[model samples]
Target: MQIDLQNSTLSSASLQKSQEARKILESRSGSGHDFLGWLQLPEEQSARVQEYLKIAADLQKLDAVVMVGIGGSYLGFKCLYESLKPAVGTPAGPEILFAGHSLDGDYHRQLLEYLEDRDFGVVVISKSGTTTEPAIAFRLLWSLLEKKHGKDAAKRVCAITDGKKGTLRQSADDLGFHSAIIADDVGGRFSVLSPVGLIPAAIAGIDIYSLLQGAMEMCDHLRNDKSDENPAVQYSAYRNGLYEEGRKIEILVYYQHAFQYLAEWWKQLFGESEGKDGRGIFPASAGFTTDLHSLGQWIQDSERTIFQTILDVEDAKSPVLQNQKNDGDGLNYLAGKTVHDVNRVALQATRQAHADGGVPSLRMKIPTIEEFQMGRLFYFFEYACGVSAYALGVNPFDQPGVEAYKKSMFKMLGKPGHA
Candidate 1:
């Protein structure tokens, strides 16, 4: 209910210094880049989105839309779509799907099963066209398409790949599929604004313009309006200060299972941005009350090696429970207690106790974890990550470290998993 940030962990001194960061933010507001890299639109960067929308209209006639990329591929678009659960005009219209991970056969069979009577469209994404999971999955699906729709089946597909040329690009061209190129300079994790993300979002009927507007506004807030009032500087100061205070392991705890995606999104943002050359918070996630079973022991009684950022929602929009009915056992104390209410109270109590004790909890209680909320979270984390990188003198946009595994994986004969 408060427009002001409700639960902040910043001390007075740290909050005060955020004013300097705000000044730096004001200078770069909308004055900086539109899109991140070289695949500029005919006019402005947003013009490309309009073009993608036209393409999406045709592609949406299909029943399901499958994307074939990983990391940023799945995190940004999947997080937004699943969180929003956006309304669609038709169940037969385009919906978001992924097919670029795991070697398991059941899911592959299930995908085929789902497409039994459905006319499917796909967007296969790979900047290099060489990411293993995506490549193998896309190839398998490409074969399926040929079986179903014939050699020109690529007409029903869209390929988001390298700009000038790549294996995917050439394949798409040869097969006559429409194409959207990933920008040269923007890395996959940071390519959400690029066609890498927008194309699938467009297909899914998401208000990507609104999503980008939120990003643009947050960018403006980070650059031109980031006073101590701004969340970006405030969160960064609190988090980095905690790191300086030896709270190195940050467990991002969320209660609602749906909001769990925020954990992965946060991990990639903080982990990729700050974890350079042996530095940064070790980002981890907990679906609270649930993780209280597994991670709670270590957090509560183990070595004092952790802190928490609990992502709480003001309310779960839908909650079902029985009234104060009389049963055999006298359960009066818990009779009227809805699980949602109990969960919130428990989380609040946990926050208070952690703060009262030596361990500090950064309670980022979101107003709601809906589309706009997710949009807000994405912007907040992105700007905060930028500030963290700026503070540490690293480029937030590039991810050389993330690419290291691909290099090593190509050298190996087969999949050697990651935990």
Candidate 2:
């Protein structure tokens, strides 16, 4: 992976700030430092790979597996599954479905109906098991599983939550379900490298070992290399520099459709980590060639308060040739070119055009969308988000503001203590 910042100019102060922030992160002395468990996960969790693989093998015997969670629990695994799944054919493992991310009645109703006939497993993720959405979804799904499979239902469910105690943990023990732990130091947004994300990805047939290896390598690199050359440091410095210059919004641009959920995961990571204390750059995402038609005009002509960071995949893997034809479709001006060639040109052209329109940008070149590179990508952003948020003088791990709505909702529902 390579980060090109030709269009982004970082000041010396910003660079120095990034260095300090890296120190703070490395020393584990920063605010919310208790949540720094993710820094060691790549190495620490490596030992559990075989265990997760064995569990995945069991789950794959089913027709499908439903992953139930919200926020970090849902996004990280979904991002990996969607981005790495085969583009055109069925996945090698069981089909993976998602729930507990929303409260839509129609969607859950249809999901239940769809699952009525298929043999499936459930992986419910929640540290507290009291997060309204997933709790409700899991209750309904578990009831259905019991009604459908009787005493065997417990064998088809896995619970990932606090190891020692939690509602989910107690349920897992009482029901004799397979279980995994969410360590005390890892927050939801940062729990991807843990079993929270890896288990589901493994169940879906992703290369979990390579993924962890990539993150491990990145972790080692960041620890040893503390210079400006470090991608995480440079990324943090550049974005923070832009933020200091009144660029209050950061747009993460990707040319491929598979990266949509990856962007969503990123948004939540940065938005929750940094968007506090009346600070933080608003995180936004756009897909190229697709959003160019709709949002391009605004990005081009509107206020220059947004900076872009583009995720550029250097290769499109399987290339499709634009076969030469003579149907007078623009006179076949260009023929025998691969579709990726056109996409590459579009990426370059858009970057140049946007830069010319006063949008300073940074480009992160990903070698390919394989598991190793994706692991590196995930760690890169996560580490950078930590440094960046610290530089912004905010806690990178806690999302205190997130409780406001939950409190209001619980009160409205007259949920005992809240009422």
Candidate 3:
């Protein structure tokens, strides 16, 4: 992966701040340092990753697997699936479905009804085990599984939760379910390289080893590279510089539709990590060409407070030719072109158009839509997010503001501890 900041307004001072941020992250001397578990995570969990692969291989024989979790628990796995599975032709893993991310009655009812006829397994993830959505969804789903499969249900259930504490851990022990631990030091959003994300990917037939390898390589490179050459440091510097220049919103733009969930994961990573102290670039996303007709106008001509970071795929998975005989659509001057060719031109045009409209932007060029590249992308963004938040002078690992909503939610729902 490569980051191009040709249009970025970052300055020397921004570079210095990024250098300091790097020191802080490398030394684990910054705020939220306790959650730095993700720094060397890929290398640390090598043996456990193999175990997850074995379990995933076993679960692959099932008809479907319902991964139940909300927020960080589910987003990373979903992002990996959305981005990789499409390139893999037929999905090699079980039909992976998600629940507990929402509380919509009809949604869960439909999920229940959908599972009634199919043989499925369950993987419930939560550090606390009592997060409203996942907790409720797990209870309902486990009941259905037990009713359908009887004593065999325990073999099909897996839990990734707090190691020795939490209601989920106790329940896993009581129910004899297979279990993995989410390290106390790893935050959910950053736990993608951990079992929380890897197990689901393995079950779905993603190559966890290659993914981790890519991340490990990137982690090492980013830690040692210079601010001028390191994509992570440059990315952090660019965003922080832009933020200082009155750019309060950063829109992550993608030319590929498959990257939608990737964007969602990114939103959570940067939003949760940096959005505090009345600061942060409000994270937003848009799929291009489609959004070109919808949000295109605003992004092109709206306020200048917005800057864009575009994820550009270097090559297309499959190419379609514009036939020379198709003159009905106007003389086919582009008859020899592939769809990807047209798309590349479209992207260049869009970038130029947006730049002329007063938008400063950066581009992250992905070599291909493969596991290794995806791994690299994940680490790149994560490392940059850490540095960017630090350069902004905020804790990059904690989401203190997130608890406010939970408090109100629990009180409204009449939870026993709310008062």
Candidate 4:
């Protein structure tokens, strides 16, 4: 992915700050340095990624696969799955489904009933193995699997959790289910390059090798390149610079619909990583034309505290030419233009309009919507997130504030000690 900072409101001072920040990161002296396991994940966990491919092959015979996870556990997989699915709509393998991301009883119930007569398997992911949503979803789904397949359920079930501990690990061992380890140093939000994400991507028929290759290449580039040339450093600096200049909210705009989940994953990554000490910029996302009608008004005129980071796909896979029409719609000028051309024009117009309205903008031009590009994009944001949080004088890895809501909910539900 190529990043364009020309439209951003960053000055030379911000670039200097980013250079210093890059030094701090490389020296491993910044906050939350111990959690840098994700920095080299693509290379370090290559063997495990291969194992995920083998498991995915075995699961291909099933009708569907349910991945039980929440938050970071599933967001990356969701993005990967949607980004790389079969372009023809006919998947070569089992359909992958997600559960445990929400607490809605009816949703889980319907999912359970939907799988009653189908051949399905389960892959449960959790660090503690007792996170409320996944744990509950696992219990319901496990019972159904065992009832449907009896002793054969053990062959279909797998667990990706704490390597040496966690309720899920113990359960997996006791029930004789296949298991993968989530290392102690790798935090949930950063586990996309780990088995937590690779396993699901593999099952969904994504190209894990290409994905890792892209990420590994990006890692090397970010590590060796100068701050001025490194996209991650440049992005962190610009974002922090805007934040300091009263741009409180950063809107990530995607012209492609497939990137909706990518935006969701990005929200969690930045939100959980930097939202401490009340000093981080609020991360928001929107799909062009869809959200332009809804949120565009506010972004254009409501406040000057908003900035935009647009994700542009440089080469579209499919192109459609506008049909010539003499009707009074005044669209004849677009007769020879492709849909992609129109979208590009819309993006440019939006950038110009927002910039003229005093909203600073940045753009990330991706080569295409493929696994390699997606992997690079993920690492780019991950590296930038770490730097941005440290630059804000906060811990980039921990999410202490997230527990407050869980505590309240657990107490209200009278869940043991929380009550």
Clashing pairs in 3: none
- Scored against the true structure, residue 233 in model 1 reaches a CA lDDT of 73
Per-residue error for 256 in candidate 2, Å, reads 0.7
**Per-residue alpha-carbon lDDT of model 3 for 197-304, expressed as tens digits?**
999988988888899999988998998886477888788888888888999999999988789999999999999999999999999999988899999999988989
RMSD to native, candidate 2: 1.1
Instruction: Name every residue pair that clashes in candidate 2.
Output: none
lDDT of 3: 0.89
Regions of model 2 farther than 4 Å from truth: 320-327
lDDT for predicted candidate 1 compared with the true structure:
0.69
Model 4 lDDT vs. the true structure?
0.86
Pick by TM-score: which candidate is best?
Answer: 2
Once model 4 is optimally superposed onto the true structure by TM-score, how far is the C-alpha of residue 391 displaced, in angstroms? Answer: 0.9
Determine which window of 10 residues in candidate 2 has minimal summed lDDT: 325-334
- Tens digits of per-residue lDDT for model 1 on 321-350? 555556557555665567888889889887
Q: Which is superior by TM-score, 3 or 4?
A: 3
Off by over 4 Å in 1: 1-49, 86-95, 103-118, 320-322, 327-339, 414-419
Model 3 residue 66 CA deviation (Å) reads: 0.2
